[model samples]
Target: MSFTTFLKSVPAFRSLATREVERLSSQCEPVAYPQGQQIIRKGDPGDAMYVIRRGEVKVPIVDEHGREKLVIRLGAGEFFGEMALLTGEPRNADVFAETEVECLVIRRKPLQDFLHKHTGVASFLTEILGRRLLEGDGIRTVGKYRLVGELGRGGMAHVFEGLHPQLNMAVAIKMLSHELVYDEEFASRFREEAKIMAGLKHENIVEVIDSEEAYATFFIIMEKVVGTVLSRMIDTRGVIPFDETRRILSQLASALDHAHTHGIIHRDIKPANVIIEESGRVKLMDFGIAKTQKEAEQEDEDIVGTAEYMSPEQALGRKMDGRADIYSLGILAYEMLTGRLPFDSPDPYEILRRHVRDEVPSPKLLNQRVPDDLAELVRRACAKKPEDRFQRCADIVKFLQQDAPAAIDLSKARAKVFTVIYDPEREEQVTGLFRRALAEARKIRGARISISDMNRIY
Candidate 1:
């Protein structure tokens, strides 16, 4: 099929006048692919949404067993991946060529520009989006806890803000959504493990106030936290101060240590699971799939956990202990210190491969401000071999509290390493720029050069 034919089928372009279509067509490049090629993969930052002009493609989601489940197939004129234009979240599914295919790929930036330039076009798309949002089958939960509002939603469940009426307190409830409950194994496992969570009592762990099977839905009521999540805090303020980060980690390590003593392993530990409460306290939550020492994978071969935060063993589907949680914590620390994950890849399989086989770059590699001692701590925490990591949660707690060895060299880890040397050319350049800036400053009459400026010049 020709690009022209493809444009006619696209809803976004269908109503465009011939002249407008021609204008848009000139901006797009015609691209083709062979059969079985992957157009996109899960965890990839969606850059563009494509319009299928010819052939077909299959959209597959990663199932619990690390296998692919074909969710839908797209043919000529059909569009998918519209979400790419809005949220920068990773693509949720993988798109593969079912046969040799051709597509009109429209990048987000260009499409955004086109919409803005054409007010009528923009309004039409907005109306379409507003209608879709209104028609969305968002889960409607009965307010056992007075529903304040929604917190957030993921593939597993929709978190909500609610008030415990009798208790007269605010709390967040992670109610298992209908779709999530559809997976009998997941639902059963969640209910079974929830019983163990009831026994968990620790300051650092989010208190599981209540667990109930209400309205045919399994729900876990947890303490409501009002402060920023670790993930968001890191994004807004890159690489927290060493002292602050250490304090937070120390608290979490203590919590994990307590949980471990009770024979419970938090198999999934990530930034999202670790909440920084309003009063500057840290609390770990989400034990829905956590494995207890006495428990087994009870017939449910489905994989559960975030790919970005999974430990090497968890990624390989091996039986994991508390060490898995330690590894995840290490990854979180690495991310917090350096504004990026230890590894990156569009393919989940590829990402897992790197986790198992690749060497993670030291935190100092990306951010020079990272102390060598802190980087070493992160390295030990993320070591591929569980034995190589801080063997006990107590050890991590000690390290964070300044009680561990101080052998790490922070100077080498800093980004810009400069030797104390005299260089005439460099000195002159620096002095020239400084003197010029100083003269301009003096012209303002309200400013004066400091003694430090004379020392720098001399």
Candidate 2:
């Protein structure tokens, strides 16, 4: 098929203006493959989407027993790898040329250029995105908990410090945000994930005390860590002292290894997920996107991961295991030691592309104090190819322990408290001001506030 013909074949592309189409067609490359040639492998990084100009391609998957199954067949004008091309993720299924195949490859640059030239297409794209989002409620806060205070909020969920009044004890309840709950599929998967995590028991992993679906809300109860998150610790204290960072990371590695042994991969492993308690205990949390190796391969491709910490295979939408998590951990370790991410880009797709193609630079190159051995460790852990990376979480843990004398001190690191003093005269003035404000607020329906003494506010 000619490049122009192939462009017309795509629904989304057809919406583009003629001038935009001409711009892209100029950059398209015509390619051909013989029967039995692999166009894209499940684990390989994807640079562009392929449009079938001629012949046929077969999408193949392997069952648990390793038997090959042909899932879908594509013919002329059909396209595969659309998601991968947009997100810079890997192919989820292997595509093989079933017959002499001719294709027009619309690499990332040309498509991006075309889109830039056609802003009208952006609105059409937004409408498509809106339809996908409208499919579900996303995540919702369905139940009520004593709003003790904000414990933390990440990209996906909110953590709250709450009191289980009936039990007369304090516990942390993490509720999936309304946006996440709205997607019924994500919500259902999240509930199942909680169940799967509940079956896991380990000293390092934070225990999942209880989970319940109440009033159309999904909540997971967990033990609260009294200290700060690793991100904050790194920010406040600077790169953890080598010995201390190693110790804390070793604990993390041990905890991750335990999860992997049980077939759980913590797909997201940035510093924020690793919590350091006052007692020096390290706990891993947030398994919303984590999945077992077997489970991950069985589903449709999902590009739901933090770009900075995502493994190349994960970014590409390929089946992943513990190694993927290991890659993320390596990124965290590099950031902790150097105080900067290995790659930086304003666009997430660009960052993902870098992850897929760029080599992880040495940590020592950025921070002169970083030891050679530590730099080498980070490089190996962040290797673009899964096979070239650490074979397991345990392996990286072992290396960190032996290489770094100063490890992350979960015990020494504690959350800071800022105290403010209030004067009696100032308190009275504040009370008077608040009373007037409340009187006005009361006029507005659905207004609410808690009354407390001025001294208590301090």
Per-model TM-score on C-alpha atoms: 0.56, 0.56
lDDT of 1 at 295: 57
Q: How well is each residue in 168-283 modelled by candidate 1, as lDDT tens digits?
A: 89887776753345456667877865676678888888877776665335777777777778888888877776655776888888989988889888877878778787787998
Question: Model 2 — which ten-residue stretch has the worst lDDT?
Answer: 124-133
lDDT of 2 by residue, 88-201 (tens): 666667899999999887686555555544433333232222222223422122243443555765544556666665675667777664334545677787897687678778
Q: Poorest 10 consecutive residues of model 1 by lDDT?
A: 122-131
Top-lDDT candidate index: 2
Clashes of each: 3, 30
The regions of model 2 sitting more than 4 angstroms off are: 1-149, 165-167, 298-300, 404-458
- What does the lDDT read for residue 342 in candidate 1? 85
